[model samples]
Target: MNELVLTLGWLGIYAPMALGAASSAIGCAIAGQASIGAMTETEGGYGRFIGVSAFPSTMVIYGIVIMFTLNRDVTPENAGGLFGIGILSGIALMYCGIWQGRACAAAINATKEKPEIFGLSLAPAAIIEGFGVFAFVFALVISAGIS
Candidate 1:
């Protein structure tokens, strides 16, 4: 059982990064597709579309930081803490990334239609990013208390 627990602890350490990266990849792809479509329709300001598409990529960076924090000794005493923090944070980040991507896509599409509302259109995506930040910050705080 010790060996199994240790293995799980290691798994927990890496899960955040894996899940986060996958989430970010999907999110970025979704937004990128919208940006590509918008680019074809717009005459200028292609840079804003490209910039908005990258909004979801920050989730992966949060995951990487969580992974590093959790990569310490995987003893049975703290394995459960590692598992809980890693898995929960990973799920939060994953969902946030995906939804944020959708939000960014919507923003891009809306802005392409009415360039005047470009900044306003990004409100939803920005709110989604805020949630991701909350998860990331909470994970860091929780991880510190694990040991």
Candidate 2:
């Protein structure tokens, strides 16, 4: 139905931001809990723990940007493209955020034991972030051709 299509189009337009926020919230919470635990064990380097916990927040920003980019008149013609790209990219970003959080938590736990490996420990999280970037870029590029 045309109404269903337009409704889905609207859902797609907002899905990225909503999903991304959920992703960031879960990711940040996971890393933040580890950071808190680590902080209690260590005497210093509190800043880095807090910083690492915030890494997952980037997904929400990406989502917001993608939402804006996808914004337009939601008609049956473009609704399917919007839904597919928005939902798929949102899922990718969400996956990245959640996994990145776990990675950051791992890094925090490891670095708490061996402070010298701080930089190296972050590699996994950075790599996860890269995957999110790829999704973001793909959405942007593909959405441009939608209508």
Q: Who wins the lDDT comparison?
A: 2
lDDT tens readout by residue for model 1, 24-87: 9999999999999999999988999999999889999999999998889889999988888899
| TM accuracy, model 1 | 0.97
lDDT of 2 by residue, 1-147 (tens): 999999899989898999999999999999999999999999999999999999999999999999999999998999999999889999999999999999999999999999999999999999999999999998999999999
Clashes of each: 0, 0
Question: In candidate 2, which residue ranges exceed 4 Å CA deviation?
Answer: none
C-alpha lDDT of candidate 1 relative to the true structure = 0.91
lDDT, each prediction: 0.91, 0.96
Q: Least lDDT summed over 10 consecutive residues: which range in candidate 2?
A: 6-15
In candidate 1, which residue ranges exceed 4 Å CA deviation? none
- How many residue-pair clashes does candidate 2 contain? 0
